[model samples]
Target chain A: MSTLIVIDQAPYGFWTGREALDMAFSLAAFDQPAAMLFTGAGVNWLRKGQRPDGVGQKSAEKNLSAAPLFGIEALIADEHACQQYGLTESTMLPGVELVSNIRDVLGDHKHVVFAG
Target chain B: MSASNLPERNNEGFLEYATDWSSDVASVIAAEEDVSLSDNHWEIIEFLRKFYNKHEMSPPSNRLFVKAVKDALGEEKGNSIYLMQLFPGTPAKTACKIAGLPRPTNCL
Candidate 1:
């Protein structure tokens, strides 16, 4: 069964969310079927050109940009979350699919990990 | 200290016995990496040691290290560029080495 990792928080503020992404990469390294869903504040992570300089943190945008190299290509961001954050598909990084019905998408996976 | 006086270390230069770690050992190793320990460097080294003591592992990567530092210290000190400036290389690797902790297994 494919594992669906749901990221519900913005990156850089807490290690938990970043750790979850690390777990996804690790799982992908082992050839597991893993996909990620960005909902709520997690949508911020998909935004393009994130600096993260003010906080002295590495840009999660960079990591997300490299996610495909780690075999994590199934990236989805919640459409409602994008709207809430006032982001359009053009504003997010490439390779992300925007979904209007998050529940329908979640139904496709057998396991879910909330990385919030 | 001379090489003979140096504490036993693994091939990667991690101290064989964590108890053998001291500011002196850290200084010697940091110097090898061309980093002179400032108060800021010491703060990160101490934090890395404590993190290893508690977690029994180094942070998995630089991103996590920056997040941990930001959470423990603050943003000004926790960012990657600040760490890269002090360590002059990968912060997680260099800091863990000087802190006498094992090389992080997952860092690349």
Candidate 2:
């Protein structure tokens, strides 16, 4: 079964969100199918040209960009969250699907995990 | 190998002085992990060294390590499973140790 990891926080403020991504990577390492949903402040993570060096945190962009390599091909961003952050598909990392109904997407996964 | 035979390292086996790291040191550490060094392994070790040189720190976690590898090497060799096959238990920890980089701080 696959796990849906929901990220709800902006990067660099805390390590929790990054840690959650780590868990996703770890699970993928063992051949687990995983997907990610970006919501709330998490949509900010999908924005392009993030320079997290100023905050002394590695940019999550690279990680998100590489998620497909880890079998995490399904990346969904909440439509409202994207609108709230003024982000469009062009502004987000390539291949992310922006969805208006997140509940339907959540229903498709057998397990769900939240990080904020 | 005993500590005396190895270069000075921190308690976790990371090099106390990164400059002291060499291919020989990496081989020794990999041997301890029962991993035979191949060109594939050397590629990652060299990559980690360059990453540390550039960033002044090892990739802080597996996610970052995967991303860094993907950025440097491309998608085929950068996936988590590919790395795990080369460095079984935890690719970031195992690779950083063999590369003589300091242990990544935020890794679980």
Candidate 3:
């Protein structure tokens, strides 16, 4: 069975995104099949070039970068929302699937969890 | 290990079990970056819970966050700046860790 994780929050800006990603990676680490769907504000996480040093916490970007290592390559993002947020395809990180709505991806998965 | 391997934790080592932001844990990690977890933090936490309940998924970027804040508190009050202000450490990622959720992808 496959697990679907949905993200609608931005990384490094809120706890929701962080927790959600952690859960996704943890699930993957535990040897579960999983895919993440990005919606709403979650698309910002895919945006490349994050510099959170202004504060003092470890860069949340590191977690995102480790997804593939844990076998979590199904990173999806919302294209329309990205356009609305002024984010273009060129600005997103590598391995992101620009989709119309996350629901389409959600439809294919058996188990889904929301972390935003 | 049984289904219930052990009590998750006694709460004594909650802080210790948390992911260390810095490598050196010998000394105080400077409160300058830490922010007090507040109602706003809870609000986001609850939002994450509901979000999970509805979609059974994790939050993506910051879209749901800004939207939720704007919806709950007015537009003026709903910004990444406010999230950062309320949650002392790092705005989104750190606060989420404190909230006991998983680490967000794409952030480190």
Give per-residue CA lDDT, model 2, range A1-116, as digits (tens): 68999999988787878888887776766667999999999898899888876876667886666577556758899999999999987888888888999999899999999985
Error of 2 at B97 (Å): 2.3
What is the per-residue lDDT of model 1 for residues B1-108, given as tens digits with 9 covering 90 to 100? Answer: 755677989887778776688888888998788888999899999988776655445665666677678878899998989999988777888998899887765666
Which residue window of length 10 is worst by lDDT in model 2 chain B? B52-61
Model 3 lDDT at residue B34: 56
Best by DockQ: 2
* lDDT leader: 2
Tens digit of lDDT per residue, candidate 3, span B1-108? 221322132232112233332222211221223544456556665654454333233433343345445665677766877776765544445544444334444343
Total colliding residue pairs, candidate 1: 1
Q: State each model's CA lDDT, in order.
A: 0.81, 0.83, 0.59
Interface RMSD of 3: 12.2
| Native contacts kept (model 1) | 0.00
lDDT of 3 by residue, A1-116 (tens): 68988887776667887777778866764567888887887877777666665865445555576565456758887888888888887887778888886667888889888985
Second chain TM-score per prediction?
0.91, 0.93, 0.51
Off by over 4 Å in 1: B1-108
Stretches off by above 4 angstroms in model 2 are B1-10, B15-41, B47-94, B100-108
- Candidate 1 residue pairs in clash (backbone atoms < 3 Å): A56-B79
Q: Model 1, range A88-113, lDDT digits (tens) per residue? A: 87889888988999998899999899
Q: Rank the candidates by TM-score, best first.
A: 2, 1, 3
